[model samples]
Target: MQDRAEATRNAVLHAAAELFSERGYAATSISDISERSGRTSGAIYFHYTNKEQLALALVDAHFSAWPSVIARHDATARPALEKLVGLSFAVARTFRDDVLVRAGARLWTERKSIDIEMPLPFVDWITTVERLLAQARAAGELAAQAEPSRDAPNLVAAFFGLHTLSDVLDDRMLIEDRLANFWLLLLPGLQADPAPRALLARAGGRVTTGHPARVPDGTER
Candidate 1:
């Protein structure tokens, strides 16, 4: 019974995420999620007290996926410059493929009137990225003057800039192509080594020569 209830809850979240992506948070109705998930509105209410709570839950789920993705590329295993470059590319790929992530990215800037407290999970994700960049600096992956906590926000802004522009440039260059180009251009400022050039080339190849991951169909994973 517990497993079944959990499954139902997940189903509702999955449906809600899809609807929220297609229609912004303010526009998505609880009834839409109910119809999409084949569940009653009362079931959704049982799982989440209200739409605001549901939106926060979706944000939490999306942010939770970042740490595991970052962990996959250990800073210690690779040159710091390479690690930083790899992290950028990995994050771009993750962002482009995940609709919930895309939606959450949109929401982070646009959300209003939620009355939520500090976004602890998001703060933690940013801190972890900063830590990784700091590790890269300590390991001589970055310039001696490099500071991750101070600089990571700029890098994050650059990343979002690329993401935002990718949609506009989709006709001129594929989103993956734009992501590679964006990273290539930004990496030089972060590192003092020439290896970033090669890494950028490899990343471009990975995107242009490979296929983009399909957009996620559901949120259960």
Candidate 2:
């Protein structure tokens, strides 16, 4: 009985995440989630009291999963600059592969309607970049005039804008090309040695050109 109930709960959450990602919270409905999940309304309500609570749950799930990506990069003993470049690719992969992330990102922009206490999604990302930039500065990896405080937010803003562009173009792979171009343009300003571009070339993988696949269906891929 417990196992069956857990299955039902998972179905509802995945369905809600997909709907929320494709359609903002204002437009999504319990009936919509129910239809997508092929579960009854009672099943959804059993897992969530209402749509607002469900939305918060979805965002929280995304946040919980996000840091593991960073932790993986940190585990590699890579320098802060390498980690910074790696982190951007990891995030692009996340936004491409995870429906919870896509929905959570979409929901974050609609937090005013949810009445929840969740922090803005970008805040944690910006903080993570700030810490990395500080590390880079301490190690003399950054330019002599590079300010961690300023550069961290600028990096976050730049990536955030790129993420938005991927959504508009419906081509997540565009991020890799743009990021390659972005690094080409920005790295000289940020790096003291100018040798770190090799790190991107080594790890950044093939830059594919293709039509954007629709956002993932929130199932763990």
Candidate 3:
């Protein structure tokens, strides 16, 4: 019984997410979710008190998957700057693969007037990036005068722009391509050595075009 109930709940949430993406929150009705999920209106109401609560829940669920991605990158023993670059790629990949994220983006923009508390995932991602920037600064990876909070948002905005482009780009640009390009373009401004010319030269000379290089042993170059 518990399993069945959970399945029903997931179905409703999934259906609602899809519908909410297709139709803005204000335009989507409870009946729309019910019809899409093939569940009765009573079932949806039983799981959620109202559409507003369900919308919040949807946003909550969408963000919940992000921390694990952050954790994986954090566990890597890579340089702080590299970790941040990896995190940006991961976020871009998530936005590409997850329909729920696309829907949530739409919902966020559409309901900007609504007084929904900013989602925790967003807060956490920003905090993580800020922490990384601080770490990079401590390690001499960033310029001495750099400010994490102010600069971190710029990186976040760049990632968001990449995600937005993914929605319209003809041949879905790979996350790595976007990340490498971003790093090439943006890293020079942040780093002391500023390898913009070198990295771009290496990237341009590569045979596979924008494919990330691999060492002779087949590991990522």
Candidate 4:
């Protein structure tokens, strides 16, 4: 019975993620999720008290596995800058292919209407980037003028903007391309050696390459 109940909950969450990604949070309804999941309202309410809770659950599910992904990548013993570059591609792919991630990101953008607290997903992302940038600085991979505290937030802002644009244009590949271009443009200003073109090529080569083990029991592929 517990396993069956867990399956039902997953089904509802998956259904909700798809709807939220397609329609945005304000426009999606409990009934829409029910129809998509083929589950009764009672089933959904058993796991989530309301739409807000449901949306939060989707966001939580999307982000919880990210730490594992990061830890695995960090274990590769690569340069911090290289690790950070690879992370960008990994995230772009996730946003492009993962429905729950898309839903969580969309909810973050529309959080005002949902009246939720600042999404932890972005917070965690920024912190990870900050740490990577700091490591890059310490390893002498960055320009003397580069400040990780300053640069990390700016990079994250650019990433957020690019992802949002990708969502709006309905073009996932655009982000992959644009992020490459962003690295090309920014790395020169960041790296002491300023091998922007070569670094850009290397960064591009790393995207969609690493396989962080699947988030267990989550609806991600």
What TM-score do all the candidates reach, one by one?
Answer: 0.78, 0.87, 0.77, 0.85
Q: For residues 53-116, write the lDDT of model 4, one tens digit per residue.
A: 9889877877775877788769977888878888888888888888888888778778889866
Candidate 2 lDDT tens digits, 117-203: 776666888899989889989998889888888888888898889888877775464566666666666778888888545867655
1 or 4: which has the higher TM-score? Answer: 4
Error of 1 at 173 (Å): 9.5
> What digit string (tens of lDDT, one per residue) describes model 1 on residues 70-92?
77766346665566567676776
The candidate that wins on TM-score is: 2
Clashing pairs in 4: none
Error of 4 at 195 (Å): 2.1
Model 3 residue 46 CA deviation in Å: 1.0
Model 3 whole-model lDDT (C-alpha atoms): 0.72
Where does candidate 3 stray beyond 4 Å?
A: 112-122, 143-146, 168-176, 196-221
TM-score of 1: 0.78
- Number of backbone collisions per candidate: 0, 0, 0, 0
User: Which window of 10 residues has the lowest lDDT sum in candidate 2?
Assistant: 205-214
Flag regions of model 1 displaced more than 4 Å. Answer: 118-126, 143-150, 167-173, 201-221
Give residue 111's error in model 4 in angstroms: 1.9
Ranking by TM-score: 2, 4, 1, 3
Span of 10 residues, lowest total lDDT, candidate 3 = 199-208
Model 3 per-residue lDDT tens digits across residues 89-171: 66766766776775677677765755567563456667888999998888898866678999887777776776566455522
Q: lDDT, candidate 2, residue 121?
A: 61
